[model samples]
Target: MRFLPFTLFLFSSYSLVKAGTLNKGDSCNIGDNRLQAGTYQFWSECNSQTYCGSSGKCETRGCRKDDFPFGYAPDDKLPEKCPKGQFCPDEEDQCQQIQPVGSDCQLNRDDQCEGPPNFKELADTSGRGLNVNGSVCLNSKCMWANATLGVACIVENTPYTAYGVDGEFIDIVSRGNCQLGLYCDAAQKVCMAEKLFGEACTADKECSSWNCLGSGVCGVSESIPHHFAIWVYIVVGLGIFGGMFGTLFGLYWTHRKQRDEEREKRMQYWREQNAFHQNLLAMRETARASILSLPGNGNSSARSTLYSRDGAFSDDVSAPILPNAAPKVSGLRHYLADDGSSEFDDGLMMQSGKKVDGRF
Candidate 1:
């Protein structure tokens, strides 16, 4: 499946030129079977030209600089060394065709093929090697992005580095302005981080890998997982908050209602109390007039009669006491109207606090 894409790329390059167009026996000077026209088709994709003659075959691509051998552009030429052990540096000192950009690519620490490339892949891939915090704090686990040394990412480790600090692991490959809480983009050849911890970036100060998009966030594409659980958390938090508010509101309402009821009860009691005092005072006035008119006796004929009112002068002990005490009058005397033309005799007995007529 991977070969299919390569084949397509080659086929497109060779467009007008067919695969294996040259025959083996046709080239007596160079063994033709060793190099077929199909190979010529593969070299043409970058719009590079194929010139084959004797042992010399030059494949040219577009816009290459005067120094390079081959590339996406011409002028960046690369020698047509048909096979392995070929040095093809098309402008990019680290770039080569042996392991094309996408193919079994490898970036070493040194400049040469075996000497220790300046940069290396993240893993010990291509059977090359893994730099475990080499030239840095090796207590923690870490890897290099590429031999270019333009980017690096610090992988946090539980166990402290040999240095004994709780800090981050030192990157094996460090080139860009990376500090704490930052990552480097070896592919794009740029320094990056999620909201840069230390380094400065023109685009995204917080970008971890690529550009810090217009949203202004750095590193991860999403702050929250954008999952059902995220929404659930938000909803649950809101519900809890709302419940608290409602509880407080309900309590306040209940408290207010209770207070209002209590106040009303107090007011009602006061009104009744005030009425009681007023009634007593009026009764005292009436008693005073009655005493003044009395004939020295604490009795009157009308006072003996039973009134229709519910508490009409009853002698019940629980009944309210009169506001004023009646004056005592003697039964040993007769009484006459104001003119002294008539005389009368009568008596009264204080029974159960009410005057009883006496005819003895």
Candidate 2:
């Protein structure tokens, strides 16, 4: 980010239009009267300058051509340029040029970090900047380490601890359900210690040894505490579904609907479709009979039937079709057609072993 000086930087300049001698011959445009030019102050406030700037100031692009005896800006240095954004401090002077600086840094989303130079170790004697180690110093200053980003540094202290502690990194304390001396997810900040209501326990699994008391250090799950939301979610879900099933049939009946009519209509449509299917099956069976030999009455031959299905027909519909090999009466037979007719030996028909001829 662009750093402002926090204050204005002022400077003095020697350039201002003085009422010195206008030192040349002057004349009146009308009539032949010649006027001698000695020194002239601004004849009026309207007598602005020897130059007319682009902004019409008394500088830069000088006077009009009509004002000059010969032409405008006769001298090569008749004008002075200003900084792009700024104008002159006064009409007689040149403008100062200044470079632009942005107000903020470009965002760097590397999940990495950035910063100004830091002080690694402050001097005890002299109150100056820093004394860094080999791993420090970028442009003569230290850099702070980001533990989260795994940024390393040749520091004099352990990470994640108060600067100058014991030889150990950090003293152990269970943040949640993790042990201090054991492994814990540092990101989660939880430890595997027994967070008991009364006293600190040796371990989480020692609840039974502590007599499973309400006040002693014990495992969270001798009867573990649940997240408030887990119980809320379960209860809310149960209530919603239970209320759906256990309706008094009042609000549910008045506002909610049975959908039984739609159900029945779908079922009737299915039945009509099934009947149409059965007719198709009978036709298929008749076609099969034309090409294939028929099973005899006494000399029975076991046969299998393939059931009819509407959609992707993946049903393993193979089943024995016959009444007697001792009349095993294998099952309701299927003819390869989209009908509800069960294929049987006599023809495709059966209702609890009673014959009723209809299209499937």
Candidate 3:
């Protein structure tokens, strides 16, 4: 009794490992094969009769020729005898059914025999049953139940699932039934995990975060924070203000320098004008002193001297002539006064045998 539980545990573990590897719609033969890819059904042929069970693997189908004694229940009230090769088995005494396929039962109607046997009653020809949980009657034949997630399935004659079946790869997922964190890969008819940031993507729906960049990739949104924007504006404003201040300062300094240079030029011109005026005044004073120290008086005889060049005066000894007087010439002596005008003097001289005489 204790070994029973251990045996069941080993069987279930083996079943899980087997099911995890096989997907739906795999092609398999009855001999030397386990359950179908997706379902737990089995099939095999026995004595030219193939029998299929929900969980048993077999090669052939239909009833065996040796067990032909069974028959369908009789609908008539008459006591009919068993046919030549068939017998009135006690298990079904209601009526004697038809013989095996090749036997001559001489019965013309299908009502003479019972319907085909149930698939579950068949033996496992492959000895590969997994004791699947959900086996049910489908179309009067037993097979595994409908498929679910992670289960292999045949869709439109094609194999698909979490893993593949029948040597086909599962590539795409259909819409409307994908679990959370998974999206339908429609091209391959399979579900795939959602895309993260920077992963290759064609649309925002394929990503988990709902953002897609322009470069055909998934990513975060391109938006700046409010504080960062404010900082940027402040930096630009400060740059503009500094540039304006620098320009104004440069202009002001250049204007001050130009004004100072002009002032110095004007001062030098005034000094030169003042020195020329002083030199002119000193020259006028020196000229006035020299004029004051002259020997002649303003109205003396030197100024009133007149010349008598007549021959009668030249011979007269009574003529008053100043001694040491120069010989007479026809020109006048000039003197300058303080008013800067000229004064002229005219004198006459007579010579009688070396006795010089002058009358002014």
* CA-lDDT, candidates in order: 0.36, 0.31, 0.38
lDDT of 3 by residue, 1-360 (tens): 000111112232233332112222333333543334332222122211222233443322222222332222345232354554344422122234443322332111112223234324322222222111222222223233233344343221112222325652332212222334444444554556778989988644466654456687887633323355787889999999999999999999999999999999999999999998789667655754564355542333332344233332333344456685433431222222223433212232223244224432
Quote the positional error of residue 42 for candidate 3 in Å. 61
Candidate 2 lDDT by residue in tens digits, 97-211: 3212212211110001122233133211221111111011222122322222222222121112211235423212211111112222234332333234445444322232222
| Top candidate (lDDT) | 3
Ranking of candidates on lDDT, top first: 3, 1, 2
Best by TM-score: 3
Residue range with the least summed lDDT across 10 consecutive positions in model 3 = 1-10
Q: Which segments of candidate 2 are over 4 A away from where they belong?
A: 1-59, 63-283, 290-293, 297-328, 335-338, 341-348, 353-360
Q: lDDT of candidate 3 vs native?
A: 0.38
For model 1, how does the per-residue alpha-carbon lDDT over 128-190 read when each residue is reduced to its tens digit?
A: 122312222212212333432335443221111111167433212223223333444434645
